[model samples]
Every structure is written in structure tokens, then in C-alpha cells.
Target chain A: MTLELKDVSLRFGADTHIYPTSLTLDPGSFNILLGTTLAGKTTLMKLMAGLEKPTRGEVWFSGRNVTGVSVRSRNVSMVYQQFINYPNLTVYENIASPLRVARIAEAEIRKKVESLAELLKLSPMLERRPGELSGGQQQRTALARALAKDSDLVLLDEPLANLDFKLREELRDELPRLFADRDCIVVYATTEPTEALLFGGNTACLHEGRIAQFGPTGEIYRAPKDLVSAQVFSDPPINTVTVTKRGGEFRLADMAAWAAIGEFANIADGDYTLGVRPHHVSPLARGENPVGIDGKVLVAELSGSESIIHFTMHGATWVSQSHGIHPFEVGSQAKLYADMSRAMLFDKNGTRVAA
Target chain B: MNNKTINHAAWIFVLPVVALVAFNAIIPLMTVVNYSVQETFGDNTFFWAGVIWFEEVLHSSRFHDALLRQLAFTFTILAIEVPLGVAIALAMPRKGAWVSVCLVTMALPLLIPWNVVGAMWNIFALPDIGLLGRGLNALGFDYNFTRQPGDAWFTLILMDVWHWTSLVVLLAYAGLVSIPDAYYQAAKIDGAGSFAIFRFIQLPKLKRVLTIAVLLRFMDSFMIYTEPFVLTGGGPGNSTTLLSIDLVKIALGQFDLGPAAAMSLIYFLIILLLSWVFYTLMMRSEAQ
Candidate 1:
């Protein structure tokens, strides 16, 4: 559980340039690195796992400098995105291989493989080879095999990303509990925010090469520290509408709040965009507030219990979410105003202007 | 697709192959079985011999000698070739342009026709004009395969190794290339030594291909007649007269088809039974 990266960097091509300039993984907790595709998430995992060494920096495991240590010396297990199951071996044999190669006692190998198979619900198909199993079954068998290695550090490079939604959720929920007995540190990398929140022990938001933010999941999601972090937090990509102050009036497309928008009080308002989560936006009832926008409902898309309504603003779109089966037709005349207390203000350069 | 319709189409596809193989192999096989149990001195004439040739072969000094030679050659080739092929295959680059180059280079010896292989080695191993023989002689070794029985056997085994090691190399190399990087990573985590990596990962994974390589090498080595016959011509004495060479000496050279036919049947049966045993053992291991 004492894995550490002292200035670890990984370079993909011969450019001798690193993808992530510098990054560190927290030990003994599920640290999820959330980033977009090609953000070098898997590269970070590979560097940590010792499959490929970092071109520039040293990797330390258990306080020992493992810079020159080969992958066999690293004592890390990785579950790749693709199921790297041994095709020649049965589910039972695949799990038993690390033990068999280690020359463990025959009875112990059998007992361990059997119990792990049972835990993975693969007991019925233990005798079948990986080629015969379904994708989910094969993935679990692979997972079981990695678990059986009993390595202290587990680096999963989006293990559940390929599965269907139901299966992904099932495995995602079962992951923390599955490794509870071992206490092996897990570094789970995924781009999906829901998965990031699910693994919400310690989250590192990666942008380009550098970690934009590294802190507890709740703190990062709640504050976001910047516009990019806020954008990464919510779905339908956290809507932003430009808010400007002309003299004493706060104007935002045919809407003016008397006196002020409280969160917008301290910010210089020549240029500003209000960032609002879709779930937090609400339709303003007539006479409820003077600070309301007159706009046409551009598109209303209903998804189960909630509906997302896009309000056309000047040169921008403000998306408002109506909870509990509220359906609005497109092009309907609607009054839109987000609760000023719930919105965040961002200036140009896409950085949040602190209030 | 009804079962009957599906099955009828399958029989139509399989019938030609089955009939052709039966005509080529089964009819000849039945004839050999017929000859093994009886005596045939001339065309269409037979008499009950009641395992007489089998008795003669089992007791014959010549059969004993030929078998000893064949057994030595086959086992010797297997012992040297499997590990040597594996070593060369291991040294090959895992991927990229170099892999294709190395692969094609390894395939060169295999592509050379068998008789030409013998001819090349025969001239190469000759003491006067050949580079290898002259080099060895200059280095203080009196090398002569033409006159000495031991020298003939040594040259024949060496020739066989050169001619056929590529097959083993190709098979072992294919198996080696197929192993994914995950196993190596897992082995790394296990702190396995080089020998342990080879024993536990490389060897076990290469089992199926090695089985093919071993069975092929064994069968080819046992039935070897061309290269050694062309190179040694049975030998300066009797050192390199394998069962195939001896059988030909009887059947084609001496026109003793009676004993030769009996000998050929015995040789074929021995190969079939040995191949069956190897196939069974390999399949059983895989099943477990």
C-alpha cells in the first residue's frame, strides 16, 4: 500500500516529451484519474504498474526506489481494458497459474483457485477454458486471476469500461467489496464522472499532462476550483450563459435582477458567464422574481424522471432541468432564470472568478 | 435447417475426400495387412505364412541393427533440435520488420529440398574440397565420413540437424511469439528467475506447438531415407543404415519384396503406434 511516484513521467513517442509532466498516486485508497480520451490515463497506469518504465522519473514502491526494477520485481497487478485471459487454460487453471508457477503447495493452489472462482460466481464453469466463456465471465475470470496474484498494488486501466451498463454497474458496485479482504491499494482510472464519484475516495482530475486538481471527490466536485473542473463535474456539460453588468443594471438577455445577483456581487461584470448544473436550474414562475429571462424553449428532451430544457440566450444556451417528469415542448414561450444562489460565475479564459 | 438436410449436405462435401483417401491409403493398407499375414512370392500368388516374416523380423540381426540405428538418430535429433530451436526462437525479436526477416531466414533451410540438403552437406563434409572438413582437418582433427563408420554416423546426424532444425525453430518460434505480455508481467511480479520463467511460462505455453514439433521431428527422423542414403549410402560399414535405408536396400535394391513388404508394414505400424501414443499423451495433458 506504500506505492509512490517521485516525479514519475511517461513519454509515448520518440519525441522524448512526456504526456503528463508530473503526477502521483495516493496509496491505500481508490484514486481515480478522470480525464478525456488521449489524456494519457492508461499511460499513467502503465507507468505505475511497471509494464513500461517512465522515461524521466523514478517509481517508488513501499518506500523502496524501484526505478530500475523490472515488472516482475514491482509486485503490481493490472487488469487491462481488454480481458487478457490465457486462452489455453481453463478458468480454474488461469486463476491457478501464478500459484502454479510459484510452485505453491498443490492443495493450497486448488483451495485458493476454487474459493476465488466461487467468489466470482465462476464455480459452475471452472472446467471451461477462457475461449468458451462469455465476455463478462471471461472478464471476471481475468479479475479473479489478478486478485489471486495477491500483489499489494492493483492498477486497473478501465476494467469495467467495455461492459454493458448493467454489467458495468454490477462490477463497479462489487469492486470495493471484492478487494476488502486483501487491503490491496487500487488505482482505478475512468473518464466517466459517475465512475469517478463511485470511486470517490481520492480523485485526481487530469487535463493534458498535469493534474488540474487532486483532492477528495466531494471537495473537487463541489467547488471545482476552476471552470474546467466545473465542466468536468456535471453532465450535459454544465451550462454557461454570459452575464454582464452595464452601470447599475445586471443584464443577461432581456432579464435584469433588481440590485444584484448575490454571487455576482464582487465580480467585475463587463464579461462573465454563469455556470449552472442542469439539475439545479429551474423555471421561474410569473411574479416570483423580477430577475427572469424571456426566451423560447429551444429543445426539450425528456429522459425518464427528468427533462432537460434548453433556453436560447444571446450568443449562448442556458440549460435548465425540470425534475419529476416535467415535460416541455420545443419552441414554447418559457420564462427561464436559474436560482442566482446556485450558479457559479466564470470570466474569460474559462477560469472561475472567485466571489 | 432441419438436421437431416444439414447432415445430407455435410456428407456430400465429405464424400469425395473420404473416397479419395480410402482409395489412396486404405486399399494399400488392406493389401499390406493381407501381405503381413501371408507369403507372396509373385504377382497374385499367396500362401499362409502365419506371422513368419514378423517372426523373422523380430528375431533378425539386421532388423535389430537397423532399429538401433533409427532409434539413435531420432532421439539424438530430438535431444539436440528442440532446445536449439527454442534457443534460436527466443533470441528472435518479438515484433516489427526484423521478425519477418528472421522468420524468412529461418525458413531457408526448410525450403531446401531434402536431397539437395544431403548433396550440400555431403560436399561440405568431404575432407579434400569442403570448407568445413578442411577447416576441421587443419585444426588437428582427422575428419573422414567416407571411410570410417563412426565418422559416417556423425556426419549423417549433423546433416539431419542442419536440414530439419528449422521446422522445430518455426514451431517453437510461433509458440513463443503468441505469448502475451501479461504473462511476463505476472511472472515479473512472481519474482521468477530466468529458468523459472522458461519452465513455468515459456515451456508450458509452448506445449502444444512443441508436441507438433516433436511428433513431426520423430516421425521424419524415423522414416528418414533420402539425406543419409545420399550422403552416407548406408555407410562405410553399417553405422548409418537406418530402418528406411535398410528397407529400401531390401525392397528396391535387392528385389526381396517379400521380406521388404513385411519390413515396411512393421515400420509403418511402429510409426503409427508411436504417433498415437504421443498424440494421446499430449491431448490428455491439455484436457487436465
Candidate 2:
């Protein structure tokens, strides 16, 4: 069934957890809610799940208004960030809980529970309680339970946030595959932009209780509608610098000017914010129209495959993430090349100007 | 030669606590043991008596009656209070100003002195002048706690339940509040009804505190003395006489110190054995 949230908003007194928002999610592909923590991704999910009633607006499911329906009455399932399971129940029972609630036959429950357990690699721990299991195992049990429900709508609220790094990676690769055959609308909320990109689904970038941008995950990453969307879609954060376009050249804040090329050349001649991904601004000159700028390096970090450098340029601190090791000394001046062709130009109101 | 260095100074730090324990608990217990085995006549004259007091107390019909009465009272109160307290806690407001208000109201009865609670109920249940008594009589039911054993048992159990159920409520409420909201929300999404939620989620989460509650109430009610003594004073013809009251009657009323000490030892053993059994049973599921 197609789930549509129409102008739903949640307010607690004067505080708005989620502004008036609308989203239509369909089955087949994951609809990712991509944002930093407290960006109202969870609140919007709660609204969709009927856990919390919206202050205003209606939720439509398959062309029916279900705004006032209780979560128990709806065919829905949710897995929380905290590995929430029936602590007193064994892994087998935990997976069988939703089926039991639905009054399914015992044989059917056993069949579904065992299959889901095998799918989650929890067959060995079927008799173990949640308390006896590891964090990842518990979460797997919770996921198995959510899957066993086989509901039309499944909400995963940062389901891997509480797990260790290795388990998160393990689950991340399996999540999409697990939900592939299910005829349900799956909504996954996450704070990490890289996770959203990894999922490669439709994404809604939330910022301060509002949807900054909503489109295909790759599209939003390649061409963010605004500076905020770009920032929300970047890990080390999209570096931004205000530059003036005049006389067929771009002049940065007290920095050298470079000839405007491609999409940058086509924009109107006015003061605009230029946002570029950290990887685009590298220590090596590689892209078209590369402009070099010198700045004092603040910190240099290397993570086996790449070196990330934080430097201050024209009173604004910017990061340069490049492949391979190029360690720069702290407090020393270093010149970095930024690919102007890969930059996104935004107007004074932060809206993308260039195509 | 041993290479390990031993630190003897740690013993100095533990000395004071050991001394305190010896003075308060160990010495008194030894004295009780000493008294349990010997018979004392007038002031300084004493004679060794082998398990005679124990045999007498154990086989006596009087002790049996009081033991049965005590067991019945304790189990009755536990049965009434635990579920009632849990129900009340579940019904209480989870948040807002009403939370503190409800907590304070629940705590009011607990804060009252044991004797004061017994006295209050004693007066309250007086057949003629008390509100409960007059109201019951007005309702035309033949009721008199001072005369009937059944009525006395009712009054005593009611008084105990009123005075102590809040302890269970407070403990259960603490357990209930510590559970994260995610469980409830997940249960809702899983299509669990109210009883299922309680049975699967609330009861399991409350197990730890409920264990403690049942333990405390079990021990306290099993060895109950002050409240029932003040309220009924063992009542007319010893019908309401519990173990503690009977022991007191033996030890002080008849000056039968030897028998009382023996009975006290048996009482202590019973509580310890039962508590261990209860704890094991309650925690047996967890070991899995």
C-alpha cells in the first residue's frame, strides 16, 4: 500500500517537533529520512506509524484517511534504535510475538519464526532471552520480530545506531536485501549522510524540523537544491565560501579570482555562495578550472585510505578530504586546490542558482 | 621465597566495622543461642537443658495455632497488596504535576508510625463510635471486629494492607517508569492488546522490583508484631494471636525465656529458608 502523509505537523506547546510536512512513500524501494540527530526524522516517522497523532493533517494509506487510527489497529511494525525486545521472552518467542498477537496458528508462527531466525542468523540463539544476547543479536531479534509481522508499513528508527561499528556495517549491507521481496513501504531514519547514500533510495533531507529537499538519494547528493541540503548530504560538511561574479571571473573573499567556467559562468553576476564537497577540494590539482588557495592547517588526520585536512582560509575554516596520504604540518601554511567546476552556486537566499 | 608483597594495613581499615557488627549483631545472637539451651530458675541459678524447650514449643498446640494464624495473615496480605499495588501504580499518572501528587498520597500511609496506623484503624473500626464500624452496622451486616475472629482477621488484614500496600506501589511505580517509551511504542506497532502488553512487557520488566517487594513484604509480614499487637492485643481468647505476639506472651508474660529464645531461633530460620526459596524461584528464570 502507498502511505501518504499530507501536511502533518507535530507541536508540543510552542515547540514544533515537525513543521507542516507531506510525503508520499510507496512500496518496492526504501524511503530514507536523512538528517542529523533531532532533525525531526523520528518525529515524522512516529507520525507515520500512528505512535503520535499530528497536531494537524491526515495520513492516507491506500486512499483511506487513517489519521485517527491506533497503531495496534493498523498493519504496521517498527524497530527502535535501542535494541528493544521482550526481555522476558526467548529470541524465538520475541520473533513470534507479533504473530501471537495476530492470533496466527502455532504451526504458522513456528514456520515464520524459524525462517526469520535463519534469515537473521539467530537460529542458534532461538532459546536465549534478549538479556542474554549481545546488542547486535538483540537488535537482530527485534528486526526478526518486525519482519515476522509482515506489515504493509515498516519503520526503522536508526535501528543500527546503538550497535557497535562492525555490527552496524554487517547489518547495513543486509538491510536492503532483507526488505527486497517484501511488498511494503519501508522508511529508514538515519543521521549519517553516507548511510543514506549507501541505501541509494529516495531521500528526504530534513533540517530544523523541515524537509530541506526530497528526491532520489544520488540526485540530492549530486545536485542539492540549496546550501542546507548540500550541508545535510555531506559528511565532513560541504565547504561554503561567498564569492562575487563580475567581469567574467569569480572573486572569493579577499582571495585570487579564477575565470568562471561551465555552469558557474552561466549564473548572473552577483554575490553568491559557492558550496563544494570536501573531496572536490583536494591537496592535488586534478579537476577542470582548479583554483589554489593557501591557508594555515589546523589539524591533519589520516585514516589508512585518505587524509583529511582542516584549514582556515579567509577567516573561514574549511576541510579538504583527498585520497592517499598527504600529511600537512599543523600551524603551517599549505596551498589546496579546489575544483570550481564541481562547486554548487547558491543565491543570497541559499537557493541553487546554477544548473 | 615468595615474591608477592602482602598489605596488612587493609585489615586496620576493616577493624571498626567488624567491631561494630560484633557488638550489635554477633554478640546478641550468641547470647540468644546461649539462652535457648539452658534453663534459669531464680536470679543466678541455672541448669543445662537439652532441646527440651524446642521440643515443647514445636509440639505445642498453642504454637501450632499461632504459626498457622501468622502464615495465613502474611499470605493473605501479600496476595491482596501486591496485585492491588501494581494495579494502582499502572493507573497512576505517568507524568505532569499529578505524578508527584500521587506519589505523595501513596507515601502518606507508609510514613505513619506502625503503632499509630494500628491505633488509627483500631478506633476507626470500633463497632459503635468509629466511622467504618457505624457504617457497617448501618448497612445491617452483623459486624464486630472486637468480638468475632473472622471480623478481627478482616480488620487486621485491612489495616496491614492499607498501611503497607503503598510500599509495593512505590516500588512497582519506580520499575514501571524506568522502562523506555520505545517498548510501549513497539508493542503498539506489534498489535499487542493491554493485557498482552502487561503480561509480556510490564510484568517482565517489573520482575526485579516485584521480587524485592515480595521479599520485603514477606519477611515483614511473617514476623509481624507491633501493628497487630497494638490493634488487637492477641484479641479475645487468642484467636488473633500471631507468632510474634505468642512469642512475646511466652517470653515476657510467663517469663519463659528458654522457650522464647528457641522459638525465636526457629522463627529466624523459617524466614531465612523461605526468603532463600522465594529468591531462588524468582531468579530461576533469569539463570536461563
Candidate 3:
């Protein structure tokens, strides 16, 4: 079903849990709610699932106002972050519970449960209780239970967040295909930007109980509407430096200047914060148009394939994620380069100045 | 992980509890064992009774009748209290100021002394002037607990239920509250009705607490003496003379110490065996 929230807001006493926000989620599309922890993603999902009523505004499902409807009356299923399965039930029984509640035929329940269990690779463990399964297996059982209902809307609230790294990667890869042909509005919430990108769906980036931006995932990542959205979409955080514009030249802390290029001409900048992603900021190189800045290496952390370099530039800390091992000694001065074409600028109010 | 040093000093802390158990449980149990094997006449006179008293008590029709009555009472109350307590717990409000009020009221019955509960019910169920008895008689029913065997049984069972069902309610409430909200939410999302939720979610979650409630009620009700003894005084026709009352009549009233001791040992063993069977069955089901 197509779900729409019109000016929905939630408040716990005087504290606002979710600000007034409106969103329209089309059916048969994979929708991603991308945000950091405590960003109101779960609250918004609860509102859509009818688990929590909005303090104001209305929820429309399939063109009908359903704000007053109970969760049991709504055809929606949710898989929580923590693997929530009926502990006393076998995996097969867990998957079949919803069908049994619906009073579906026994033969249909058996067929559906077996097929879903096979699909989730839980065929062998179907007779085992949730307490006996591994975390991934338990989550799969929960997923199977949610899927067996064949509801119009399926919500996954950071469903892979509790699993180990390897299992998360495996399941994250399988999610898109799992719901590929399903005629349901699948909403997946996650804190990881890469997962949203990997899922390849329309995303709503939320920050501080508000939807910062909502559009195609790729488009939002490429062109964030505001500074918060840009920051929320970045992994190791976007590197920002305050710069002032005079005529066609942009001056950074009276230390460096570069001529305005392309869409920068449209921005009437007095003082603007320039944001460049960690991947875009690299070790200094002498080829082409590169905006260079001097920084002192603070710390260098090397993972398996890449190293994150923490450096101080213009009295502010910045991070640069370099492609391979590029170890920089602490307290040593280094120069970083940013390609101007990939840089983003925001005004004092944190609205993105497109370039 | 196994390389940690063992602390011998921890035994010092455990010594007090061991001594306490020995004093409170083991010593009294040994005394019962001593009495069961030996016969005592009066003024420190004693003789070897061997297994004769056990055989006599086992063959006695009076003991058999009291045992049957005790079993009937225990099972009857178990049947009534467990479901009634769970239903009451389900109806109780899960939150807000009323929670404390409900809990306190439920606990009030449990806190009253067993004899006081008996006394209170005895007056309350008096045929001529008592509120319940007068109300029932006014409602046109022949209700005289003091004179009728059926009414005596009814009053006894009612008194025990009123005295002990609160324990079950408290335990079931605890089990119900411990269930996470996620289970209910998931049930709702799956379109489960209230009965389905209770059958699949609440009942399964309450299994452990219900087991404890059943076992406790079984043991307590099997050994029940004070409440019914005070309420009906074994009744006008011995209708409410449960095993404990009969055992007390043999042991202290008529001073038949040998058969009474043997019967007490048998009673202890019966409770032990039944509790073990109950625990084993419940655990086996849980494991499966």
C-alpha cells in the first residue's frame, strides 16, 4: 500500500520525539530511512506501522486516513533490530503463527512456511526454537515470520545492526533481491551510509527528529540539500572549512585563495562553510587544479585496505580516508588536496549552496 | 579462563547458611525420622515399633479416606485458583497508580495469618447471621455450612481459595510484566486477536510461573489444616477432615504417636514425589 504521513509529529510530554514531518512512500519501491542513532528513524517507522499515534496530523494508507486505526487492523509487518522471535516456538511455528492467526488453510500454512523457510535457508533449523539458533539464524526466523504474513508494508528497523560484520555484509547484500519483485512498500532503516547506497533505494535522511532530505539514494548522496544531510550521509564525516568570498576569489581563513568555478559563480558568499568528503580529500599531488591546505598529522589508523588520517588544519581537526596505506607520522606537517569539482559549500544557516 | 585462583575464604561466608539449614530443616527432619521408627508411651517410655506402624497406617481406612479427601481438595483448588488468578492478572491494569492499589489488595489476603483467615471466614460464612450465608439464604438457597457436608466442603474450598489464590495472581502478574513489549507489538502486526495473543504469547510466557504456582498450591493445599480446621472444625460430619486434621487427631488428640509419625513421613514423601514429578515434567516440556 502507498503510505503517506501528512504533518505528523510525536511528543513525549514536553520533549519532541519527532517533529512535524510529511512523507509519501509509494508501493512496490524499496524505501530507506537513513540516519544516525536517535535520529527518530524508529519513531517515524512506528508512526507508519500504526504502533504509535501521531500527536498531530494524519496517516493515510491506500488513500484512506488510518491514523486512528490500531496496529492489528493495519496490514503491516516489522522486523526489529534485535532479533525478536517467539522464543517458545519453533522456527516453522514462528513463521506460521501469522497465517494461523489469519485462519488460513492448514495446507496453505504448511506450503508457505516451508517455502519461506527454504528461502531463508532455515529449512534444517525449522524445528528448533529461537533460543537454539545463532543470531543470524534467529534474525532470519524473524524475517521469515514477517514475510510469511504477505503484508502490504514491511518495515526493517536496522535489522542487521546486531549481527557480526561478516553476517551483516552478507545479509545486506541479500536484502535488495529479497524484496525485488514483492508488491510491497519495503522500508529499511539503517545508520550506515554504505548500506543505503548498497541497498540502492529511495532514501529519507533524518537528523535530530526531522527529515533533512528525501529523494533517490544516489541523488541525495550526490547532492545533499543541507549541511546536516551531507554530514548524515558521510561515513567518516565530511571535512569542512569556513571560507569567505570576495569578487571571484574564495579566501580560507586569510591563508589560501582559489577562483570561483562552475556553479560557485551563483553563490553570493559572505562566509560559507566548505564541505569535502573524506574520500575526496587526499594526499597532496601536483597534477591538475587542486585546492591544497597544510595540516599537522594527529593520528593515523590503518585498517585492512585503507587508512584514516586524523589531521589538524586551520586550528580544526579533519579526517582524510586514503585509498591504501599512507602512514603519516604524528606531529609532522602534511599537505592535503581537494578537487574543487567535488566540493560542497553551505551558507551560515547550513543550507547547501549548490555547486 | 580456568587459571583463576580459588578462594578458600568464600567457604566462611557459606558456613552460616549451611548451619541455618541444618538447624531449621535437617534437625527437624531427623527428629521426624526418629519418631517414625520408635513408639513412645508417656514420661519418656519408648519401644521399637519397626515397620508395624507404617503397615497399620497404610492399611487403615481412616488414613485412606483422609488422603483421598486431601487429594480432592488440593486438585479442586488447583483447578479453580490457577485459571482464576491468571484471568485476574490479565484483567489488572499493567501501569499507573492503580497497579500499587491492586497489588496491595491482592497481597492483603496472603499477609493475614492462616488462623485469622480461618476465623474471618468462619464468621463470614456463619449460616444464621453472617453476610455471605445470610445473603445466600436471602437469595433463596439452602446454605448452612455448619450443618451440611456439601456446604462445609464448599466453605472450606472457598476459604482456601480466598486465602491462597493471591499468591498465584502475584506470580502470574510478575510473569506477565516481564514479557517484553516487542512480543505484543509483533503479535499485533501479525493481526492476532486478544485470544490468539493470550494463547501464543501470554500463556507460553506464563508457563514457568504457573508451574511454580501449581507446585506451591499443591504442597500447601495438601498439608492444609489450620484454615479449614478453624472454619469448619473438620465439619459436623467429618466432611472437611483432611489428612493434616486426621494426622493431628492421631498424633496429639488421641496420642496415637506411632501411626501419626508414619503417616507424616508418608505425607512428606508424597509431597516430595509429586513436586519432583511436576518439576521434571515442566522442565522436560520447556526443553522440548
Candidate 4:
């Protein structure tokens, strides 16, 4: 089944329509509506879930118009970031709520709830009230409840955002596992760029109510289509700085950069910002080489197993994720080289500049 | 929180409630206890009545009539209002400007002064010239609250319902709004009918708010006098005389201070005891 949003626009009051946008999702593939807060990511999901109506367009589900349909008529379920559990219910009753409403046989409801409980390792807490459970347990119950619906589409609005670090890490894999067996479309939304990369689905970046880029996680991370796309995504934020082009070569602190970047070689010279991920930059020997740049180490943070080194080149500052414990003193000169093949470029307006 | 700070601040927070109870409630209760054992005539004259007044008040035919009438009136108001309010709250829109519009309109009845509420209903439900009475007469019905016991009873009940159902509606609506979209979303995916949604999700979630609504409405209806008094004047006979009306008649009309005070104490205890019972029952259910 395929879901399509065609020229959909949601206007708040009389003016300020979020955006006139269109997109499509294929069933059996995970879709991530990754965006910043207040970017209307949830709004788009709500539109598809039949919880709301778009001001101006049709929502086609399986080649049929489902716009303006009540949430009950449309088979859709969603889990929110707050881990929305029926506070008045025990975990067993919480998960069984949906099935009971469907009038499933009591025996089958018992079997399904128990089985799901075992899968999520919540057997011991099934009889416990949601109010008495821990955050992780509550979240697990919420996930189990959402998965129990067996809807054609499942929407999750950062269900893991409210979790603490260790719990977040533990359940990171369980999210994909929730949809592993279902022949359904799952749309997960999050503001964290690393989460999108971690989710590793068909990542769709929804920025400012529009898709900035929608593609495979690896491709989007390796080579973002545009500048805001690059910065709006990527953790430690892909380092960005302005560079001048001369003799058809881009120069930033004397680094010999490539002139062509995939499909961007035909662009003209202009004031532009160069983007590079911290992991792509490497420490090099201090030498008068034409292919490398030298800088002073501004700061270094050693976070347990790994260290993040800050290097200043000319007037711009950039970070490099160093291996092991590489301690550097302030004001000490440090030489670093950029991996030009992995570098990204953007114009003055923060739009990706074609190579 | 840390234990030391919590322990230190706990009594500080509880002190005001304790003091207010002592001054406004507990001490007055002691005076009532003292008065229940004595009798007084003019000029501070006192006699060891020793439960004579309590016996007389309890055995009084007027008190018995008022008590039975009070129970019927309160239950009638509750049975009519609770379901009616829940239906109105259910029919209310989930979200939008319309939600606010409906909420504000519901709150308007609450904003009217209690006596004015009585006056408004008095004029609205009058027999010959009143809108309802005139309208009913026009519709080919003999509706005179002043002369007919049935009319008086119906008018009193109807007027109480109009003035107070909004409280239930507001409380139930608040409970309904607080329910997260997740529960409904879950219900929707399960293909729940409206009735199932209410039974499984809405009713359970509304229990706490419903408790408060129930107790407040019961107390208000139980103590109700103004509107019924204004509309029927507790007249055509004792058909509309609730406990509060009887208490007022004995205390204010007949100048029987001792018996009235004794009845007032009983009335206050009934309200307090019923409120406590409701609160405890609701809390126990929540605990379970």
C-alpha cells in the first residue's frame, strides 16, 4: 500500500499556512519525519493518521482518498513522546484496551497481551498500574500498546525522547523491532539528528514544514543534498565555514580541495560555506604541505573513551573527533587536514552550492 | 526530595489548614455540642434539657417530611443532572474555537449570583405571567405552581436542574479534555464505538472529577432553598419545603432559635459527613 500527501496545506486561523507540501510513503518501509521542534512534523503525521484534516489537499492511502476521515474509520495508531499510558489502568489492561474495544475474544486478548508482555520483558509488571511503573517500563507499555493495534499505519512522535540516556540506549534497537514483523508503514518523528541516523530507515528530513531531503540514511549523512539540510541534520553539526574559489579550486586555509562534487560541479563561484563532518577531519603532521591546513588547538574534551578536539583555522573554528585520548593544551598549534572528498559546500544563503 | 527538609516544611504547610479548621469549624462544632445539651429561654435563662431538643427535632413530623423531601429532591437533581451533563459534555467538540465558545456559555450560569439565579427562575417559571407558565398555558396545559402540588414539585426540580447542571458539565468537560489523545487514538485503531469509548476510557478517567461534581451537586441540591422558595414560595403547602426551607421557617419565621440551631447543626453534619464519605470512596477506588 502507498500513502500520498498531495498539495496538503494546514493553515492556523486565517493566515500562516505551515506549507503547501506533498510526499509519499510506501508500506513495508520505515519512514522518519525528522525535523526541528515547531517544524510541523507532528502536524503532517496527524494529517495522515486521520486525527486532523489538512486545509487544502487530499491524503491518499492505498490509492484512496482518506482525508477528513475520522480517526476511528481510518486504521491508524500513534504513540506520543510523553509515553501516553492510561494512568488509571494496569499494564495488562493498558495493552488490552485496544483489543477489547475491537471486541476481540477474551482468550485471544489474554494470549496476545501475555505474549507481547513476554517479548517486551514486561511480564512481571503487567499487573502493575502505569502510575507505579518506572519511566522505561511505562514507555515499554506504551510501545506494546501501540504495536497491539495492528493498524495499517503506525505513527510515533519521538516516543523515546523523554527517556534517560541509559534507557534510551537500551531501547534504541527495540523501536525497529516493534515494526519488524508487521506488514505496515511506520512513521517515526524526532528532533535528534543522531536518532534518525540510528533509526536507519528511509529517512525523510522535514524542516520548516517541508522535506529538505528524503533518502537512505547513509546517503543523507554522507552527502546531504543542501546546506540547511546538512546543518539541520548531522550531530556535532557538520562544521561549516566560508571558502573562496580560485583557479577553479576551493581554498580554505590552503587545503587543496576538489573542484567537482557529484552533481555540483557546474555551479559558479560565490561567497559560500564549506561543510565537513568532524569524523572526516584528521590530524596531520605540521608541514609546509599544499594539501593540508594548520591551526591552533583551542580546546579538547575527553569524554570517557573518546576525545573531541577543537581546532581553529584562520577565523573559523572546527571540531575533529579524535581517536583514544588525545590531549591538547590551549593555544598550542595543531595541524589538521580536511578529507576533501567528504567535504560539503553551501552558498551564502546557507543553501547547498553545487560543486 | 530529601527527608530533613521535607519533614521540616510539612507541618508549616499543614498549619494553616489545621488553624482554619479549628477557628471556622472545630470550635463552632464545640459550641454546637455544648448547646445540644442545654435549653435557654429569654434573658440568658438556661435549663438542663439534656437531649430533649434533639429528641423533639428528630421526632418532629415537619422534620421528617423535610428529610424525606430533601432526599427525593437531591436524588432527582442528581439523576437528572449527571447523565444530562455527561451527554452535553460528550456532544461537545473535542477541539477548536467552538470548544471555548461552549465552555464560556456553560460557565455563564455559574457566574450568575445564587439569589439572582432564584429570581431569574422565579420570573421565568411563574404561573400566569411567567414565560414557562404562560408558554405551557398557551400550549393548552393547566400549569399553576402556586395551586398544584405537581406543578410546584416539577417547577422546583426543573429550576434546580437549569441552574446547576452546568457545574457537572464543566467538571466532566474538564475531565474529558485532560484525557490525552493517545487513549482515543488507541480506541480508534481498535474500532471502538462511541459507547465503548465512554465506558472504557471516558468513564474511568472521569471518576475523580465526577466525585467532586457529585458531592458538590448533592450538597447544593440538598441544601437548596432559594430558587424553590422564590418560584413556589415553599407553598401551595409543604410540597416544596426542603430541609433548608423548614430550618429557615423554624429559625427565622417562628423565632425558635434553640430548635433551629439544633437543626442547623444536624444539617451541617449531614453535608460534612456526606462530603467526607464521597471523598473517601473516590480515593479508595483510585487506590485500587
Local distance difference test, each candidate: 0.79, 0.92, 0.90, 0.81
Chain A vs. true chain A, TM-score per model, equals 0.87, 0.99, 0.97, 0.89
Scored by lDDT, model 4 comes in at: 0.81
For all candidates in order, state the fraction of native interface contacts they contain: 0.37, 0.97, 0.68, 0.55
lDDT (Cα, tens digit) per residue for candidate 3, span B1-288: 699999999999999999999999999888777788888878968889799989998999988888889889999999999999999999999999999999999999999999999999999998787999999999999999999999999988898889998999999999999988878888889887799789888998899999999989988998888998899888777788999998898898998877888999999999999899989999899888
List where candidate 4 sits over 4 angstroms from the true fold.
A4-24, A53-75, A85-90, A97-106, A248-268, A278-341, A348-355, B1-23, B94-100
Could you tell me which 10 consecutive residues in candidate 2 chain B have the lowest summed lDDT? B38-47
Between the candidate structures 3 and 4, which one is better when assessed by TM-score? 3
Candidate 2: TM-score?
Answer: 0.95
| Per-residue lDDT over A210-328 for candidate 4, one digit per residue giving the tens place of the 0 to 100 score | 77888887787767788767876876767777787665667664544545444545667665787877876767432222136677888888998677888878777888875667777
Order the candidate numbers by lDDT, best to worst: 2, 3, 4, 1
Pairs of residues at least 3 apart in sequence or in different chains that clash in candidate 3: none
| Residue A240 lDDT, candidate 4, scale 0-100 | 73
| Candidate 1 vs 3: which has more lDDT | 3
Model 1 lDDT tens row, A1-355: 4777767776656653335345455456777878777666777777777767888878777678887677766667778777776666678888987787667998999899999988888999999988678778888988898888887888787889878889888888888888776667788888888788877777777766656777788888888877877876666678877777665556665655544546555566587777878666666432223346666888888788777788776666778776666667788877765666666777787777766
What tens digits encode model 1's per-residue C-alpha lDDT throughout B50-100? 778788887899999999889988999899999999999888899789999
Tell me how candidate 3 scores on lDDT.
0.90
Q: For each candidate, C-alpha RMSD in Å?
A: 6.6, 2.1, 3.8, 4.7
Tens digits of per-residue lDDT for model 2, B1-288: 999898999899999999999999999999888889999787857789989989998999998999999899999999999999999999999999999999999999999998998899989999999999989999997889999988899899999999999999999999999999999999888878888889989999999999999999999999889999988899967989999999999999998989999999988898999999999999996575
Q: Which ten residues in a row have the lowest lDDT in candidate 3 chain B?
A: B28-37
lDDT of 3 by residue, A1-355 (tens): 6899999999989999999999999989999999999999999999999999999999999999999799888889999988888878889899998888789999999999999988888999988999899999999999999999888999999999999999888888877777887989999999999999998879999998999999999999999998999999999889888989889888888667888877887778599998988887778553345788889999988998888888999988889887778878989998887776678899989998865
